[model samples]
Target: MDLVKFFHMNGGVGDASYLNNSGLQRMGIMKTRRIIEEAISNLCKSNIIKYPKTLVMADLGCSLGPNTLLVGSMVIDEVAKTSQEMGLNPPEVQINLNDLPTNDFNTIFCALHEREKKLNTEKITDVHYSPPSCYFTGVPGSYFGRLFPAESLNFVHSSYSLHWLSQLPKLREINKGNVYLASTTPESVSKAYYEQFQADFLQFLRCRSEEMMVGGRMVLTFAGRTTEDPRGEESYYYLWRPLAMALQEMVSEGLVDEVKLDSFNLPWFTASPTEIMKLVEIEGSFTIDHIEIFDVNWEAWKTKKYDNDNDNDASTDDNGVGHAVAKSVRAGIETLVANHLVKQ
Candidate 1:
């Protein structure tokens, strides 16, 4: 399957839409606010006197949801505040929101009015304060390749996106019964997945290197494993085993073909911090300013109150936990699973 053409989070503003079901992703974005503010502050501090008049930033893999522009807005506000504090005029802000060709860019455009209102409202602590002009552009493409001109981006923010692979690994009949790296996955299959991640991540750094200006900053947050062992039993690897089990159960009940189940695999891999360090070193494009490993209770996040009330059907109550999680997973990969299930 051409994942680039077909891969995208579930779009639209409905019960099952990524917009409503992405409470977990929203939480991840919150964790990175301090880091992002620090990066933007540095950007303004370094170039306070003689920087360019326009500040360009991007949110890679900015799928449809409140989060599509959430972090981008935060960065815009930060740059304005930091520039003003340093006694410099706020620069024009151009935000590039990027995702696959199939993503919901229209929704992003629609939300701009409200975002602008909030930005304008928040900047008015004093009548004399002036907020910077903010502009939005939708850049639709894969981040695995270049999507911007040379040295155009000033600050980049990506939240909960990097672990996704450019494509599925060459399974070659390996990992036959599983859809992702799992405890039962063979050593060879595990090696193949890691090899694919290494290649894709290196390419990502290479493209970003050319797109980012000198001394630009990026704050990235994605799932990762701290263990030295790539094949080790980590929570992320274990998280998908239930889906494999469900498919197998359906097969036992003659609800789905075993062949179909055997042929499916998700394009995802979680690299350790050291593995990322090596890739950054090999790519020779960017240096790691700050990196850390943090954990979330995958189960607990589901129960936490979402940022706003929407009839997402991703219930945070105890009784609806399983249904909520299923909705969340569906919001991410319903199309992929539907195609796999119905394909001849």
Candidate 2:
């Protein structure tokens, strides 16, 4: 299947939509808020913004949801505050929210005005109440390739995005009845995944390098494991294991074909920090200024606090955590399954 044409989260603001099922993803944005602020804050403090009248930034893999504006708005807010502190004219922010062509970009487009209003510029005593003019353009395409003109971007931010490879790895030995790297997956399959990640990640860095100005700041947070063991990568287990088990149960009940399960594999990999560092060293476009890892509870999105904190309409009872997770997984990969696994 052509992933660019077919791959997308369940669209519309329904119960099963990615718009509603993305609390865990929202937590990611909140968790990494500081890194994003610090990057743009430092950028504004430097001579970079002093020269340019425009600030170009992008949110790669920005699927449709309330969380879509969370980071983008924060960048605008930080730039406005920093410009106010320095008594400089704020630059107009040009935001490119990039994703596949099939993503629900309209859902994001409809909310840009309100996001612009709440820029948090209390410190700016200009009395005119002027903040940076933010222009959001939905770039409907994959981030695995270049989406911007050369040296045009000033800053870039991506969270919970890079783990998705451009395509599935070429497996010499398919791990039947599985969708991702697992304990029973053959070493060759795991190696295939690793090599694919290395290749795709290098392309990603190369594209960003050519598109961004020299010393342009970027904050990237993705699903990365600390363990070197591919078979034991924690995020994959939590993210894919449950869905794989459910598929296997269907296979046992003869509802799903064994051959279909044998051929299907998810196009995702959770690289470790070391693996990422090695790629950056090879890519040689950006420096490893700061690198760290933090753990979130596997069921963090199941908390009642998440419902109250985020605009997500997804609610989970104590026992509904499992069901919520199932729905969440479906929101992400139902296209892949319907196209590749269930096609008859």
lDDT of 2 by residue, 1-344 (tens): 57888999888888888888777778777777888888888887787435468889988998988878888879988888888878788889988998999998888877775554655533665684457888889998888899999999988888888998888888889796578988888999999999999999999999999999987998898888888987884756676888888889998898888888888898888998989999999999899888878765436668746424646447354556777777778888889999986747
Please list the Cα RMSD from the true structure of every candidate, rounded to 1 decimal place: 2.5, 2.8
Error of 1 at 337 (Å): 0.9
- Residue 38 deviation, candidate 2, in Å? 0.7
Model 1 pairs whose backbones collide: none
Computed on alpha carbons, the lDDT of every model, listed in order, comes to: 0.81, 0.83
Question: Residue 128 error for model 2, in Å?
Answer: 8.2
lDDT for residue 63 in candidate 1, whole number 0-100: 93
lDDT of 1 by residue, 139-216 (tens): 999998999999999988888789988888886546777888776778888888899999998898889999999999
Question: In candidate 2, residue 136 scores what lDDT?
Answer: 88
Pairs in steric clash, model 2: none
Q: What lDDT score is found at residue 264 in candidate 1? A: 86
Q: What is the lDDT of residue 250 in candidate 2?
A: 90
Specify the poorest-scoring 10-residue window by lDDT in model 2: 304-313
